[model samples]
Target: MPRWFNTAGPCRPDIHYMLPALRRLPDVQRLIAQEGYFVVHAPRQVGKTTALLSLAQELTAGGRYAAVLVSMEVGAAFPQDVGTAELAMLDDWRNAAEAQLPPELRPPPFPEAPEGNRIGSALAAWAKAEPRPLVVFLDEIDALRDETLVSVLRQLRSGYLNRPRSFPVSLALIGLRDVRDYKVVSGEEDRLGTASPFNIKVRSLTLRDFTAQEVAELYAQHTADTGQRFEPEALALAFELTQGQPWLVNALAKVAVEELVPDISKPVRRADIEHAKKLLIDRRETHLDSLAERLREPRVRRIMEPMLAGLALGDVPEDDLRFVQDLGLVRMAQGGGLGVANPIYREVIPRVLSSTAVASLPPQTSTPWRRADGRLDMARLMEAFLAFWRQHGQPLLGTAHYHEIAPHLVLMAFLHRVANGGGTLEREYAVGTGRMDLCLRYGPDTLAMELKVWRDGEKDPLEEGLAQLDGYLAGLGLDSGWLVIFDRRGGQPPISERTHASDAVTPAGRRVSVVRA
Candidate 1:
């Protein structure tokens, strides 16, 4: 059978084109040799399980150690019942050991110790019974929470000193977060700090995404197997869009080859990759949907809200920022600041956040905002937008969840609705910036727009908005565009009094249309 890209669960080399799982985890062997207890973490589906399982097999086969990878995810279901969660987790460990280990190395039946201490007792009994030193990779250790999470980590800490005799010689806690990020909440919401619970961890290691060369090598495997090639530009575009995110790299290739262009004889092209990206975003596949679900979380909001508003983050906790980064949502920007991880995420974030408003957009009533020769008619488009803003902008802004970006989202939704068939809109915004830039592409025409907001106690931003738009237009090779400022201050003039449009010239001699609504 022909191997295809794998997106769900741990990748199997027999079926999926993949890089060596251990390439990004160079210290695992050394840590294990030193009898260390450590945490291995990365964003979801970045091959944590695959690497652990593969390493466990390799260790077990070496004839010197007994190794097994067991999952703690089942325990997460019984968070409130420590006894039941511990029992379930121990059972999972026994089952995994039996399947992966030889009879000589398989763990003995769990001990009859008390509920909360069973996991620790069982590990001690197994280590005592086994002939050789044992190593354990406890996958999804962070999935457990509250008392259950606390119980297991404490049990491991309790067993730390008995290595190679009364307990496993070494162990790894694998999940999406470091042990420090784990929370232990008790009655009345009492919490334990990081130092006490899982402090036995010698080090916390993170698995990184595939590098650019690794991504190419993965694609090359598919090409070698199927005799179909991805063009140079296509591979470059894939890396550019995904930033070497493993799942995204595979998903894009899978979509392009299997869905968008299936002719094995033909090479995949850059345009096909772009279309695949749009398809994935439009379909809201499970991966992207899962990411969107995190947007409502308080910690997620603290980091993302400022990003969307193009305002600097004000005193957000360092842990909160690190937590967001661990989830693969944001990364350090080239000029040294936080930004969305990649272009695909950059596009997905705003659209997903504004989906509700997009759904509520007024039906497009304007004739195609296109000239007879099929170019976008900027004048016609602006006329329709001014009319739409005057009619529905206020009501929509009132219903938006992100109040800071309400006006910007509403306008984008409107533009997205009108530009759906004939054009595409790209956006750029970042923390510490006070404006959102938009570039609309339609056939041979490119339209640049700059959006700013005047909140309470702030003066009109017309001069600054015009200057920014001038720079933006120059970048797009255009001499004219739109500078839209939304007046959100209280005690303002009525809509009829304040809503209007005018034209201005920039210091660089660029003409800009200024719209205040």
Candidate 2:
């Protein structure tokens, strides 16, 4: 039976693998045929290595190409020593090639390292003696030290002209970022552009996440193999939550199939997917941890902060945006705004970044809300939030995400606790939104909040606050809304002064309340 869920990488042969999408790239095939150097980059575990290995198998099976997939990841340990790094990389390559080669066609002794150009010359000599065109896929190409990486790229570029007859016909550098964005920063103000060494690269391809249809196709494979089916809603929820990120998609499916589902006879349901998501987040797997690490980077912060603030980031360099996109952190929409790439990522980001804040949240009163005839007391919830902010808001504000226009993460933590299980919070923020807008959906009742920070020496923010809240409520189809403003104008004021102040009125006959923290 096939393992439907895969997290490390794709399983061989029986994994219901998809190949046509990558094979369709024109440049990919051209390089494979004409002996060119290129790059295939995307977020870790998004299947860059898997796709390359699959291609390598296909090329080798044709009996017209000698293909090998080598990983440089192990060389990352001795990054500064080029000699040891090169040796480790070469050893990995030789082992992978020998293991994959058919017994009848295996070379007795692999090609030895030659002087001048270590990797390129050895590879060139191997191709020269081989009966087929040489194709090498260098995985984890970015793991090498800056100097060594430059040397390797330059060697490949120099040897490109001697293809099929004297050098490798096709060379691929697969890593976490595109080759073009590689900035080898060594000394003071010394930035070596990736293009300088790898100018011969005709194309850079990014392995994109599986689409909704693809996710469904992958799941159907398991059902066909073992007669264990995922419920229709469960399948939909899987795509909705994972947005087809390969690791998350496979991990969630694995949990549902191997753990959550009772037996082959029972169909996996949406609740199963929810359970899997919770387990994955709780476990804090390496895939999730690696992604969370990117959130702390300044470049990532610049791009993500504005989106969290519901405002557009103007004039950001294309490279920065592309880097984040490759990391699978954000996705661009047709309308030109950025959103959290997928549901799983969206959920993970808030949870990982707000751990401290969530732990310190104040306890709600037993009579948190007063009910009149089984209806929720919306006013009471607001009052509770106000009181909580007064006591714990400043301390929580210290944990606020500073890169964003406002402290959205802190506000989100507060809302997350209050609305947990009982309600849902929908977020809307883009590059140009200027403020973060959240709508709380509790049963049939709906409440909206707009969050902003005091930027300059503005004395009264009443007009801006009113306009913002009015727009949010209108969009949410609500009669009344709250505007929470954090007064950072005083530069970290005392906790006592961070009290909630409201000008109570129903402007435009739509209830509007402003809370100051």
Candidate 3:
């Protein structure tokens, strides 16, 4: 059986194998034949290196070109010292070349250089001497220092015109970001334009996560080999939770096959997939850890805060939006808006970002608050939130998303504490929606709430609140609804003092209550 859960690097053919992106291969081949420099970027572990390596092998197998894959990732560990970094990179390249190439085709001893273009010159010399067309795959190209990166890219640029006979005919720079954004700085404080060094790049390709169908195909391979069938619903549930991220898809399957299923003859079920998701989340696996780390970055937060609040803005530039999208932070909704990419990301984002705050929340019974009838008591939850805001809201406002339509995070934290083990809260938020709808699924009942904060001195919010609550309650198939509106206006009276009014009845004949927090 093949091992499919690969977290370290490119998938090894002898261990874990994958379906080739045949549709992309023709384009890659065309670029190589045209002697073009190109880029392949994707979120980490989306199979960029694996695809490039497979493409390199295909090219070399044709006997038309000699292909080599070298990683510059190690060079990045030592920054500011270009000389030592270059030597380390060159040594790495030589070792990889020696390992991949056959004895008869191995090049002569690598050249020695004290400084100036050692790597570039050595590679150019080797390509010139080899009879076959040379193709090079530079993995993790972003790892090189500013000076080292500039030197390497400039060398490739200078050698581009002398392809097939004088220098490498095809080159690929693979990393997390696009080559165009790469900024290389020289020791003399001169900045080399990214476009100048990699000007020959004709195209950039990104390896996307698998679709639902593709995820099925991957798991079917294991079933074919072992006669262990995955229940149909298991695959669907996996897709729902993971959204077909390659790593999570594989990890979930590994857990199901190795841990959940007691015997090879038994079929994997939805329960198995659910168990796998919980195990992964509870363990806080490395992949999840790395993903959580990105949530704190200011750029990432700018895109995420709005989505969390269900009010995505449209003023950001295309590049910034694309960068976030490329990182798998958000995806385009069916109606042409953006939303969190998947359920796992949605769940992980809140827990990771507000871990500190969640920890500080007082225990459920410790506070002077308790939900009557074992439900998320909106009255008590909101009171606690208002008290928290009165003390910490201002200090946190700079970091808090006050500009958002609904501060679902703060409210969710309060409810999360109250409903810690007894129930689950499901949140639905999307970019450009301008509202957040939360459903607290408790035993034998459900509570539907629409969270919105008043801004700019709006006096009577009852009508707007009713309309929003109507939509939320209808979707949830509930009769009664709660619209918790934050009174951002100063000097607002307490909930007891403010009028508790009911708007027009919903279709189910249940009235929607508008409450001020």
Candidate 4:
């Protein structure tokens, strides 16, 4: 009888703590009312299926259409074989209709049709037989690739002229990507460069992540259901960490209330939310794991590599940028720049990238950095890193897939090892910044660091590095930090011979450790 936060699939109000699914995407109804065929796309697990299913039920209940939501995912199993894919998809469609629709609203049997035209033919038969106009939301449409994908799109286009009376009055192709992105993924970008097979689409709409206010409303549902309340700080932190990602919004709450602090009498606090985030990232739950797995993707690395190293994104193709954005790996700011979509991803990206380097680390590397007081001794940590870099940094660079950011990745891997079990390392970088900032948090010790590279035809960058580390330290409310300048010019000495730490003062007179390697 209790309602809980839903993460796995479409929210069922009977047992899930959720906002109105249609509320997040009110424009969907307007598009349908115009009798348009369109696409609905967003990153995975952000409630695309939930919103579409809720809309189908709402429209059917309004008595205007016999609406149903079915998936093309089952068909994706036969990506190259259009005949088998269509057969599986139609079979799925029939089963979905039987389960969701009332007997009066369900279509009669699907008509027998040959391989190529089966989906179109069955849709036509259903549209003609229904008492009211039919509306269909095809989920996971982009899951198809190659010829099967092209066939599906063209078939939908083939039936475009016949509407309401023969074909569904309105239809939506729902997935993680827009039509053009699908083309790019399937290696047909050049062919579909000018026009997509699904060109009849009126517009491509994406579901937005929940606003902070929406996050509060969703968490409040749990409070209303039980006596537990979320402290105001916990609510703000959850939104800050997740930026109102639906699954993250729910998953954070689920972990906090269900596992971290399960007592109904205890209110969820800011610390609880923070710990929940740590647990989520550490566990690499299915959703986060899938997103992390994309870091090495060719399209993904093209953008992420420079961003990770805090360098300019040089002449990246528009679709490639959009492809990563569509995957939800990163988000574009209102003023037009790209960054990792949320803090959680920012954490996951480098962690995933540094995983290989971490494995290559000697076990003795972490031990030397930890003090008896359970604190990560910053001095010892840096000393261990200098030794590790001298010994293993060269080979570790080869382990990184992102060549441009290999040094950055190697350093993060060293820090990850130092903070292996009891510490957290946070990173901040932006394109054009020319620096990557890191914050390592142990029991009661905090170490702030800034990294920069000295390339050919460039100045020493020590003074600039000091200035940047000053700003970083000021933000962390610390009096000092480390500035690592990797001298990557044409004729630098070996890492072991050149690597050494020296003391310097920032413009603000904050003492800084300048490590030039």
lDDT of model 3 at residue 459? 59
Error of 4 at 506 (Å): 1.1
Q: Best candidate per TM-score, number?
A: 4
Better of 1 and 2 by lDDT: 1
Which residue pairs in candidate 1 have backbone atoms (N, alpha carbon, C) closer than 3 angstroms, thus clashing? Answer: none
lDDT of each candidate versus the true structure: 0.86, 0.73, 0.71, 0.87
Q: What are the per-residue Cα lDDT tens digits for candidate 2 across 1-517?
A: 4444667765565654343446324467666775667888888877777778878887889888878788888767764566677777777777887887765434334455643367776777778877777788888877665667777777888888788688887888888877766546442123344456788877888777788888888888888778888888998999998888888888898877888885999888898998898788768898999899887776787788777666567787777787788888999887776888987777677666776677777665464653655445877887877777777766777765554442567777777776674666667666665566777776677878877767667656566767877877876678788887767675666746667656555456676778877
Give the residue spans of candidate 2 off by over 4 A.
15-27, 104-116, 183-191, 359-384, 401-406, 416-426, 439-448, 457-481, 490-495, 501-513
For residue 337, what is the lDDT in candidate 3? 75
Candidate 1, residue 361: how far the Cα is off, in Å: 3.0
Candidate 4 ranges beyond 4 A from true positions? 184-191
Clashing pairs in 3: 312-432
User: Which pairs of residues collide in model 4?
Assistant: none
Full-model lDDT, candidate 1? 0.86
Instruction: Write the candidate numbers in order of decreasing TM-score.
Output: 4, 1, 2, 3
Off by over 4 Å in 1: 185-192, 362-375, 494-497
Regarding lDDT, does 2 or 3 come out ahead?
Answer: 2
Of the two candidates 3 and 4, the one with more favorable lDDT, higher being better, is: 4
Candidate with the larger TM-score of 1 and 2: 1
| Candidate 3 lDDT by residue in tens digits, 250-326 | 88998888888958899999989987886787677888898888776656667787777655565765665776787
Cα RMSD to native, each candidate? 2.3, 3.7, 4.1, 1.6
